[model samples]
Target: MRQAPVSLPLGIVVRRTPSVSRWAPWAYKAVSVIPGAGAADWQVLREDGDVIEYHAATVPLELWHTDTEAYLAGLSARVPSIGVVMRDDDESAHPYEILLATASPYECQDYADSGEELLELVPMPEGLVALIRDFVEEHHEEEVFVKRRRDKKRIDEVEDGRGDPRITQLTDVYRAPRAGRPN
Candidate 1:
């Protein structure tokens, strides 16, 4: 499939874990992955006053292109904003993080659906739609829905008694309440 050329305004956060040594003591190794200690490394690709708060150091966040259409469609229709998962690089016990932004509905939903990741919906920021408009128009194809027509010859009601064209009296709905009995 040919993908459209679109630029998304987003960044990722990563935590630099201390290098492990095969000869290191068990206690030292255990403390290295303590989950909270390494979380201080959370930083966006571009530092723009964004920071991860109380996020784990191991989980890696990413954005994929396949979900672009769903993101565009969803953002355009229902979802008001997007979400992100990372760590709050500051000193804190919690090593994992979930943040909300008004930019990436598709990526937000993708992470949210992972069963483990959490999402916090917020109001989409101004101009986010304009950024997505060009991309959506280039990639989204509105599905044409065709309604199936009902056959006019088919009986419309249960009382019509299809395949049995003979009409009976209302009192004799089922061949006179009793079989072999005259109404």
Candidate 2:
């Protein structure tokens, strides 16, 4: 029997600092994730010097049985991280809109490849690490590697339609017709 998918509420915290470049005034990045946090979106959490951190959004960190391989790969990393995806929203007060938080690196790579959203890798909390580890332990099944054997038939033995039928040549059937030669 397959186990039900596990979901935990994760509050994503984003930190903003003054940018050195003139084009952009502020630089934003996801700093941390609060496990089981139930805070309102865009709520100011703390400020230190010129840096400001906000609880950008609370999203579910879901772990499905089908995605155990991805979760396992993430958990085995040197620094286990959770992916925070923020979309660009020009209409909103904040430049970025907080999207979902994911534990799978493959999913994060897909979003990053699109070049439409900002991706941040935040360190996963100890609790979340244990939770995801347990989920993987319960659902993950090792797949046996199968080597594909090549077919026995020799493709070079047959000369069926090897070259253009319009040009007939005994030695080099695939040679291009010379300018003076007739096709």
Candidate 3:
């Protein structure tokens, strides 16, 4: 198929200690075998103030010239998902060399205001998405926040660490059994 010049906003940059073997480059080549793979490109960019090395590439939506979905499925069989990292060139020092794995894919528009940022786009298999979603769901939560008491009371000592023991007492102080109920 004819290659089309498509440009995607540079998002996140990721650094990894690539395997020190011939397989490293070979692995990249293998992924490139998928259709539309050539369209996806990458470039090494400057690191952030933290000195984290960064690389930017386009997410590949094809495999072996096959549809994105098919390629993703095949990748899922081998890898959990792909990872990428991002950093701003204007904000970093020269010759930075620390690689950090990004927890998620970043959106280029999200940081457009930064002006001429460097992005390392990477293709992650769909399976990685599932893993991330599951992890977030299991870890992130929304609820009321309360400070813990430093002093340990008798009831507090008896109760498990899940809930505050003073909750019942606080509720009663506000309003109790309609205030006119029998003993």
User: RMSD per prediction, one decimal?
Assistant: 12.8, 4.3, 18.7
TM-scores of the candidates are 0.37, 0.84, 0.24
State the lDDT of candidate 2 residue by residue for 1-183, as single tens digits.
776778888999999999999999899989999999996678999999999999988998988988989998899899999999999898989778888899999999999999988899999989889999988898889988999999998878645446766776775557555567676
lDDT (C-alpha, whole model) for all candidates: 0.42, 0.89, 0.36
Worst 10 residues of 1 by lDDT: 27-36
Q: Which regions of candidate 3 fall more than 4 Å away from where they truly are?
A: 1-112, 142-183
Worst 10 residues of 2 by lDDT: 157-166
TM-score, prediction 2: 0.84
lDDT of 3 by residue, 1-183 (tens): 653422222233444344558754311211211112222233445444433333434343211221233323324444433333234333444222223233332332333345544333345535545544444444444445898877664563432233454685423443324346674
Q: Number of backbone collisions per candidate, in order? A: 11, 0, 19
Which candidate would rank higher by lDDT, 1 or 3? 1
Query: What value does the lDDT take at residue 105 in candidate 1?
Result: 61
Q: 72-128, model 1: which lDDT tens digit per residue?
A: 755666644545453332456434443423245656566667766444443444455
C-alpha lDDT of candidate 2 relative to the true structure:
0.89
Give candidate 2 regions above 4 Å deviation: 1-4, 158-161, 164-183
Predicted structure with the largest TM-score when compared to the true one: 2
Rank the candidate models, highest lDDT first.
2, 1, 3
